[model samples]
Structure formats: structure tokens, C-alpha cells
Target chain A: MSSSEDSMCRAAVDEALQTVGGKWSYDVISRLYYGPQRFNQLRRALGGITVKSLTDALRQLERQGVVHREVIPTYPVNVEYSLTEKGRDFRAVLFQMRAWGEKWLPGEKDEKAEG
Target chain B: MSSSEDSMCRAAVDEALQTVGGKWSYDVISRLYYGPQRFNQLRRALGGITVKSLTDALRQLERQGVVHREVIPTYPVNVEYSLTEKGRDFRAVLFQMRAWGEKWLPGEKDEKAEG
Candidate 1:
């Protein structure tokens, strides 16, 4: 279904991994839940992403069923991206990952584990 | 902390990812949850994994306090691996990923989502 050539299963997992298996993916998608965002807006929200890396991530998510992209079609060519229904469904997973990550993934520790 | 030198956060996530992020990782860990498993047992349990990949995953998980490795030291040498408490904590997340993946991944879908 994608422009790239690969087996159906391999391609699908690869595509899904492209969205989920990375440092900043959940962070980026988590930010987009609020509303549609332009390219620059997303870069601003995701603090340390390089332009190329961010573009790659957004394109990958768009390929999956998770992201919806709208072309603003302005002079310089503006575009807005947001979550699709499937993408929105990932909100719960994202929250779980964040909480679990902060709990276990070093430095974000709350230190208030209930006794 | 265990022989790897990098930024602490980077090193930690890298170590955790070494345990979690891969093709056969979750499958291996999930299988170990049943009980302690020998090396050959794990290889047989995980149908598609190569020896190299399995060995690496086992070592990484061992380092992370997730997979406990007990050496039998028999004639040839035998090793058994099982999940630790922290590793067991990931059971819920693993179940979620498997279910969600089957639902949205390449295959493994249920027709009934309770409409």
C-alpha cells in the first residue's frame, strides 16, 4: 500500500514501528492530540527534533492509519497534521507509556511510589 | 552501570530498548513468564529467532534486572532464564501491545469489537 516495496506483514510492522519504536515518536504524537499542527509548530513542540528527522517521523505516521495531513495550500505551501480516529485511539497507549516511562525510565522519577 | 559508558539517560534507554525493542524480544520475554526456561527451550519456544539474537536479548535483559539467568553448569553447560519482578511488571504492557498489534498489525485480528 505504500510507495516503498516490501512484504505485506513486514511492511506493516515496519510502518507501525516507524510510528511507535523511537525516542521522540510518542512525544510527537502526544503533542498532536491537542489539535492540528503545522510543520514548524510541531518542531517547536518537540524540543530536540531535527527538521529531517521530524519530517521523516510525520511521513511515517501519515503512511500508517494514525495521522491525517491537510495541505494548507498557501503561497509557501502550508500544511496541518492531526490524528485520525485510529491515531486518536493511541492516546491511551501514549499516556500509559508516558506514565510508565516516567516511573521507570530514569530522571523523570516522582519518588512517591505508594507504600 | 554494567560496563556501558554513555550519558546516563541515553545509556538507560538504550539498555532498556536493547531488552524491549526488537523482533523476538517480547516473544521471548512473554514465553519466559510461564517458568524458567533453558536456552534450547527458549530457542525452540521462539520459532524464528537465531542463536545470536536470542543470546544478545537474554544478556541485555539480564543486565536490566528483568531476565534472571541461572547457570546449570552441566556436562555441556545449561542455562535457564525467567522474568524478574520488574520484568513481570511489563506483562500488562506486553498483553496490550500483542492485542493492539493483532488488532491493528498485519495479521491476528478479531472480528468482534463489541458493536
Candidate 2:
């Protein structure tokens, strides 16, 4: 590829990677796709994730406009997160990825083994 | 979605995320897709990556069978990394992400401005 084309591809890919291909962003997006989930609820759904990691992930998604975060000014300040339209669009991509993974990278002997 | 379906989807999604949706793995993959690249070459291509982080990323891809590392039996023992066919399949995905980002998340005023 020409240097210019390559550079253009790199720029767009980098931006997209930073936006959605983040470490925990997809996981967080997957969790919120179902409905508006609260902070603790998201934390529990994404098991084994540290609080800081979850917070950072949420912040990144929020900044990208993929996540809708609503704060309920209640006794404890309940916060809920849901998917924006862009976020919902990723549902197809995520589902495709899930199918791809099961078909190609099924860690163990899925049903029948293949080399 | 049903609980069983959700669990299955989660499992497949998690496995896929671990496989290709890694932090710098796509960057590394993009660099290697053209041809075999040396470790230092990859570092420079993906500027600002720590040697340790690069090593860790490479190790992850190697473990998942996406990157194939070949050690050059030369005077200095140079090591080269390249992508497998399975890895090349993600080329389409990476390309799509680039297009998506250009349209949706272009950082600056992309060629034309949009709100």
C-alpha cells in the first residue's frame, strides 16, 4: 500500500480501537446492551473486574457517546448505564464476534476436535 | 435473551475478545499483515509501546496461534513475527472498523465538518 493510504488506514483504525476495542469497553458494552444497568449491577455482571477498571471503562465509553449514564440523585446517588444508538448498533458486531470465536477459537475440545 | 443463551453468548464473546480484541494485538497484526516484521520494526510502527508491553502482546498472540514467530538463525539471532491465515481473516474486520471510525468517530473535522 502507498504510505498515504496506509497512514489513513492507521489513523481510522487507531481511533476505532481506542473507542470500542478498548480492554474492557466491549465487555461493558455487552453488559449494558440488555437494559439500563446500575453501577453495582454492571459491576456484578462483569465479574472479577476491579472497581477502578470498571470506572475507567465506563468513563471511556461515556466519552465516546456509546454509553448513556444517568445519575439518580437519591440517597446513595444511584447511577445507571445503557447503550446509545451507536452502542446498540455494535450488537451485530458483537454477535458476529461471538459466533466467530465459538467457531474458530473454542479453547477446549468444543464438540469434535480439529487440528 | 434467555439465561442459557446469554451465558453462551458471553462465553463466546469473552473467548473472542481474549483472542483478537486485545489492546495492541490489532496494531501489531496490522503491521505484520504486510509482511514479516522484526520486533523493533513493530515497536516503531506502533510508536510509544514499551518493550515489555510489546513482548506481552506478542506472547498473547503467539499463545492464541495468531502470530507466528520465526527466529532468524543469524549472527545476532533476529526474530521476525508474521500473521497466520486465521490472523489475516481479521483484515476485513480491521478495515471495517477503520471505515466505521472515519464515519462515526473521526477525531478532528474529518475532511468535512458534521455535528
Candidate 3:
């Protein structure tokens, strides 16, 4: 490939990584992939993630257009998060990564067997 | 998915990210996708990467079993780097990321037009 094409390819990959490569971004995206989730539901699902981190990740994802935030008119007002079209498209990359990991990385079961 | 299954999936994705998510690891892997490369060739291709960073990234990939290093005997011994089967498998993820980026992220051309 020409140097320009190489650079463009790198740029594109970098953009994808920057969008979902945060500490808690992937975790959030993975959960939301199931369905839309309320903030508390996401917090409980992620376990060990701080409220601030989850909020930050959500906001970043929202800004990147990978996630959509909706406010429901309720007693206390609930905010739900879900993947946008772009975010849904990211599932392919996530699936591929998971598949590669399963094939190459040793799981807890494998570790136990080796031990 | 069950909580256990979710955790396992997350762990797998995390493993893949940790292996290839270094600052220059993706760049290195991208260049090597074309073919095996000498150290200097990779350094030049990567552009702006320091020797130390490149060396560290290569060593990490090597340890992770994603890259293989071979010593070629010539007038002076020369070392070359190439991807292993596991590393080649990573192309799926890379291709997906690139596709997602092209679809979602704005390129320089887009920015120029907008400007």
C-alpha cells in the first residue's frame, strides 16, 4: 500500500480505538449490547466500576455518537443508555476480538487445568 | 447472558485488548501484515516511533506469542520479525475496526470539505 493509504488506514483504526478503548468504555458497550439500560442497572452490571467512571464513559460514548442517552419522564426521571447505529456496528469488532481471545488466551478453566 | 458468561466474555475481550492495545503495538502489527520486516524497515514505516518504544512493543508482542523473531545469517546477522498464526488471526479484528472507522469517523477529506 502507498504510504498515504497506510496512514489513512491507521487513522481510521485509531479513531475506532479512541472511541471505545477507554478503561470502562468496552464494558459499558458490552452490557448495552443486550438492550437499553438504566444508569443503576449498568452500574450494578459492571460491578466495581465507580459512578463517576460510568458516567464519564457514557458521556464520552454519547459524544462519539456510539451511544444514545434518553431521559424518561418518571417519578425521579430515569436516564437510559443504548448503542446507536455506529455503536451497533462496533459489535463485529467486539465479536472478532472475543473470538480471537478465546482461541489464543488461556481462560480460568485452562489455568486451573495447567495448575 | 448469565453473569458468569458475561464476565468470561469481558475477560476474553480484555485479554485481546491488552495484547494488542499498546501505544504502538497496532501500528507494528499493521505494518507486519504486509509481510516480515527488518527492524529498520519497521522503524521507517512506523514514522516518528522511537527505537525504544518499537523495541518494547515488539518484545511484548513476541512474549504474547503474536510475533516471531528470526535471525538471518548474512555477512552480519540480521533479525527479522513476522506474525505468528495467532497474530494473523488478529486481522479480522483490525479489518472490522478499520471498517467501523471508515463508516463512522470523519476523515481529513471530510474535514477539509466541511471547513
Candidate 4:
């Protein structure tokens, strides 16, 4: 590849990584992939994520256009998060990642087998 | 899925991320994807990686079994880095990520078009 093409590839990879590189970003995204979720539901889904961290990750995902936030008009307003079209585009990538992890990594299943 | 399955999935994802979470880990892997590279060649290929950071990343990848370091016996011995089978398994994921970025992220190409 030409240097310019290489740089462009690098830039694209950089953008992709920025979306999911954080400690909780991918986990949050993974949960949202199941369907729309309320904040508490997301928090419950992702065990051990602090309220602040979850909020931060959601806001970041929202800004990146990978997530959509909706406010429901009810007795008490409820906010829900879901993947946008752009975000849903990541489903295949996430699936592949999970598949790779299971196939390649020394996972809990292997540990159980040895134990 | 069961909670045990969820945590196991999380653990696998964690391991995958551990291999490529850093600023330069993926880039380093990307470069090494083509073939084996000497340390200096790697340094040159990845623009602006500090020597210390490069060394640290290589050691980490080596420990994770994603990268193989080979010592060449010559008049002046040379060390080369290449992707192990485990590391090469990530090529598809990285390619998908690049495609996702190009399609979803407002990248340099889009900016250029807008400009």
C-alpha cells in the first residue's frame, strides 16, 4: 500500500479502536446489543460498572453516534439506550471478537476442564 | 445466558482486549501481519512510537503469546518479530474493524469530500 493508504488505514483503525478501547465501553455496547435498556438495567447487566463509568461510556457512545438515547414520557421519565444503525453495524464485529476469544483464549471453560 | 456464561464471556473479551487495548498494540500487530520484521523495521513502520513504549508493547504481546520473537544468527545477530498463530487469528477482526470505521466513522475520506 502507498504511504497515504497506509495512513488512512491507520486512521480508520484508530477511530474503530476509540469506540471500544476503554475498560467498560465494549461491555456496555455488548449489553445494548441485546436490545434497548434502561440505565439501571444496563448497570445491572454489566456487573461492577460504576454509575459514573456507565454514564460516561453511554455519553461517549451517544456522541459517536453508535448509540441512541430516548426519553420515555411517563409518570417518571425513563431513559433508554439502544444501538443506532451505525452501532448495529458493530454487531458482526463484536460477534467475531467473542468467537475469537472463546476459540483462542484460555477461558473459564478450559479451566473447568482442567479442574 | 447464565451468569456463569456471561462472566466467562467477559473474561474472554478481557483477554482479547488485553492483547490489543494499548495505543500501539494493534498497529504493531497490523504491521507484523505482512511478515516478520526486525525491530528497527517495526520502529520505522509505526510512526511516532517511542522506543520504550514499543519495547513494552512487544514484551506484553510476547507474554500473551500473540507475537513470536526470533533471534537470527548472523555476524551481527538480529531479532525479528512475527505474529504467532494466535495473533494471526486477529487479522479478520482487525479487517472488520477497519471496514466498520471506513463505513461508519466520519473519516478523513469523508472530511476530504466535505472540504
> Candidates' interface RMSDs, in order?
5.3, 2.8, 1.1, 1.5
Clashes of 4: 0
For candidate 1, the docking band is: incorrect
Ranking by lDDT: 3, 4, 2, 1
The numbered model that scores best in DockQ is 3
Estimate the overall C-alpha local distance difference test score of candidate 1.
0.65
Q: Which portions of model 2 show Cα errors greater than 4 Å?
A: A2-8, A18-24, A35-59, A69-81, A108-110, B19-24, B37-56, B71-80, B106-111
Model 4 per-residue lDDT tens digits across residues B39-59: 999999887988999999999
TM-score of each: 0.73, 0.66, 0.89, 0.87
Estimate, for each residue in B3-106, the C-alpha lDDT of model 2 and write its tens digit. Answer: 66666766765665666567777678878887999999999888779999899999999887778999999998999999877667666566666666566654
Q: Quality of candidate 4's docking, in CAPRI categories?
A: medium
Q: Model 3, residue A43: displacement in angstroms?
A: 1.3
State the C-alpha RMSD over the true interface residues for candidate 4, after superposing those residues: 1.5
- TM-score of chain A, cand. 3: 0.87
As for candidate 1, its clashing pairs are: none
CA error at residue A16 for candidate 1, angstroms = 5.3
Residue A22 lDDT in candidate 2: 73
| Better by DockQ, candidate 2 or 1 | 2
